[model samples]
Target: MNTPDVAGATGYIDTNFKGKAEKAIQELNDGCDFVYIHFEAPDECGHRRETQNKIRSIELIDELVLPVVIEGLEKFVDYKIMILPDHPTPIKTATHASDAVPYVIYHKNAEIVSGIDSIDEESAKSTNNYVNFGPDIMKKFLGA
Candidate 1:
């Protein structure tokens, strides 16, 4: 898929990306055990140097994806869901910073972890902050 220019040069956010996200979520609901989706619309908006687009993307996730995806998973009564970004690209720099992105994961049997506010401390101990430690974290979650 061609990435749309989020700047005024394009003037409009393409709707296909979100539509595809919806479809994929639906398909996963049919049979897949897990689904991992990444849409860079927010990152693209940031690259365009606007938080407004990022905010809009966030709202779309809240309004569209969350309800559909979560409701689908909840139906199984044994599924888990995790949502987070790998890293955030700053609007001003339009570049990915080596900063940690907030991450979260859940399993039907896993207790909800609370009060672990920031990834900063965990990231500081690692080589790349903001770089994903998702696989490692996932392994642990599955093992539990």
Candidate 2:
């Protein structure tokens, strides 16, 4: 059997954000110019009846996954990290939302002091670090 070079992958099991973080670092090791890590738990939680799961999922992503991925990326060169949801999933409705969702863009060279400790809707809005360019955001980030 051939071992996959990428990480965060398994068969017949639930996907975890930790795997996504591992895969991202592995991709960076494999000389990838860019890496994309996806987490499904929040959406899954939103689909369920419990609201705590959704909150916990987001917390895990922010506290656990973010630090791991960021620390791994720090080994190479500075990077611009952008975290955003495709759309809002209101736990109240337990459904998908088509409305605009807030995103956070942390430029590697940008100053991070100014009372900025985390990246979320409020922090993103207050810092003016939003990515609303849709699909073009990636291209623009890559200078394409």
Q: What is the C-alpha lDDT of each candidate?
A: 0.61, 0.68
- Clash pairs, model 1 backbone: 99-130, 100-130
- Provide TM-scores for the models: 0.68, 0.74
Runs of candidate 1 with Cα error greater than 4 angstroms are 1-13, 16-18, 116-135
Task: Tell me the lDDT of model 1 at 18.
Answer: 47
lDDT of 1: 0.61
What is candidate 1's CA lDDT for residue 2?
A: 30
Candidate 2 residues lying further than 4 Å off, grouped into runs, are 1-14, 110-117, 123-133
Tens digit of lDDT per residue, candidate 2, span 17-119?
6767877787778877677765677777777745887787788787768888888878865677777777767788889877556665666766355567765
Q: How many backbone clashes does candidate 2 have?
A: 1
Query: What tens-digit string does per-residue lDDT give for candidate 1 at 7-90?
Result: 222223444444545665666666655556666677788788878887787677667667776666666757666667666788
